[model samples]
Target: MTESPVLMSVDDRGIATATLNRPALGNAYNGEMLDALIEGIPRLAADPAIRGLVIRGAGKHFQAGADIHWLSAAAAAPPEQAFASSLQTTRAMQLLNEFPKPSFAVIHGACFGGGTGIACCVDVALATTQASFGITEVRVGVAPTPISTHMVHAMGLRHARRYAITGERFGPEEAMRIGLVHEVHAPEAVEARLEEIVAAMLLSSPAAIAVTKTSLLESNGLALSAHQVTQLTNESWMVRAGKEGKEGLAAFREKRKPAWA
Candidate 1:
């Protein structure tokens, strides 16, 4: 497979790996990276040979969330343009959450904001003991609107309400305890756990797994309506560009806690 900046590769064993390649920035999300994931996910989901999907970061962190530079730019954009950009990331996470095959996230180091959103959407989430998580948008004066659905689904409304409002960073064990992650392993053991999950996924019939996942989503009422998803996305961007959002972003950039804290 051709290696794009945002790497995507599929093995004959039917397991596909999508690695966020910008390790220098802790694999932060930008328009290009978001576009790559948005385009790649549906393609992989459509492939007959691909039975499982794995998402990881190439270096120390899974993802530090949105790139600060990008955030700053988005903050300066017109409301409509900013909302459109924000929705792209939201839609990508939604797609992964609703994907037919089993999806897994191998998380380590920092997984915050959008990164946490991505991990929450996966079927199986494994994190290194050193991993840190937060719904950090609040610190930057933005609501966790885009990721609120998945956050609530993974960690429940009570937990989401606290973390989303506080933007507190929690460790991997706490994440597992709160039902955000399935397992907490040593950093070195992450790959081994991923292999185990892949092997287990392969043992089941693909069609059955897909149908079961669909049934479970329906039964649990976890699926989002199109209008709801759009509304959330719009709300997230709107808040980010508002006065409170600006204060939060400025406080973070200046390395100080927000006034609300």
Candidate 2:
């Protein structure tokens, strides 16, 4: 069998760890990884024995968001396929956002684009002091449509608009200040802090926690209509297939400033 793009394990204590496994590319999200997350998150949500979840990344980075190569391929796909491809990251974020159990994330290094969405979706987002974050789609002339709602939810519309439009990368301190991350730790203290959170959560009433999460999400979360989904999908594809999008991708691949700049 082929190696899975995302790796998952359930510990003896019923804590499930879903790891973004493509370290060689900064744990970038590609089609396979998105599929893995879309399939894995809901499956984990449905498992009765699972207590909680910890989303993390392998190697140096947590996630650099959508793979640039995947973005290029998606840009070239048929309109129908491109729309579906654009929505996969959104779906995966939704699944984890509405997960019935407690969700946590351990972020380090680059948490860019869709990666920031994953952090926003979790109940508790922790990052090392050295971690960096950005919405960043504008840098490639692509809209941050899929991650927009979550970004707003995490950081508020004002900050979201500022970062989303500027494509500026900020440090973990800014991430925490903007409420995208709950805690920041020194590199060596991250694991201990994670365990502390996990243990505290394990002591809570699991049923009560589930109900609370469901209630909160239903009351104050992103609820998109069919038309809205289509609009966002179209927005993503439009930028990905547009002249600027092509120029941006080519510039990224060539390691140069885009033509517009």
Candidate 3:
């Protein structure tokens, strides 16, 4: 049997860690990875023992985003299959965003495309000084449909619109300036800061924290009902399976500008 594509472990303190294990591919996400994340996050969230969650990559890069090879193949897949893949990723992000406990992303190296989406969904996103980020879907002639909501939530609509359109990479300082990251630290300091934040979270009442999160989302007009989230995720998948998405994936693989450009 193939080894699992994602890994989850929890400490005695109810601190859960979710690692993206596809290091060889710079942690690029595929269908299997998405399914794993979608399934794992809720399980962790529902666990009374899990007080906090931390998301990270297995290797140097945080996440390079969607697997281009998978995306290329997905472009030619049946519409249903292709759309299902997109929905899986969208669902994973939603799960993290709506998780009751405090969620954090410990980012280093490249955090691009869907990676940015994941980081955006977390309540606290801390990046090493060397970390870089971008919403690069437009470069390949596709849209960041699924991640757009989280991106706007993290960086505001104005910044999201500019960066999503430009697909330009930015460093940790820029990310903080643009409101994408909560803090920037040395690589060695990431774990320390994460611990500090997690400790702070633990001091608050768990139930109260969850309720506060709900109130905050509602205040920001981001509290999506279950049905609304499902519907929006489905729409994201539809776009990813369409002509523009196919062309975008093809363009990236071919190392050429998309025809739409």
Residue pairs in clash, model 1: none
Shift of residue 47 alpha carbon in model 2, Å: 0.6
Each prediction's RMSD over C-alphas, in Å, is: 2.0, 1.2, 1.7
User: For each candidate, what is the lDDT?
Assistant: 0.88, 0.89, 0.86
Give the residue spans of candidate 2 off by over 4 A.
none
Per-residue CA lDDT of model 2 for 204-229, tens digit only, reads 99899999988887777465556766
Question: How does candidate 1 score on lDDT?
Answer: 0.88
User: 207 in model 2: Cα distance from truth in Å?
Assistant: 1.8
**Residues 1-261, model 3: lDDT tens digits:** 766778888899999888899999999999899989888888887888889989899888999988998877766778677777777777888888889899999999999999999888999999999998989987775678778888888899999999999999889999999889999999988899889989888999999999999888988888666676667667766666777877887878888878888
Please give the TM-score that candidate 2 achieves against the real structure: 0.96
Pairwise TM-score winner, candidates 2 and 3: 2
**Candidate 2's error at 235, in angstroms?**
1.6
- Best model number under TM-score: 2
In terms of lDDT, the poorest run of 10 residues in model 3 is 232-241
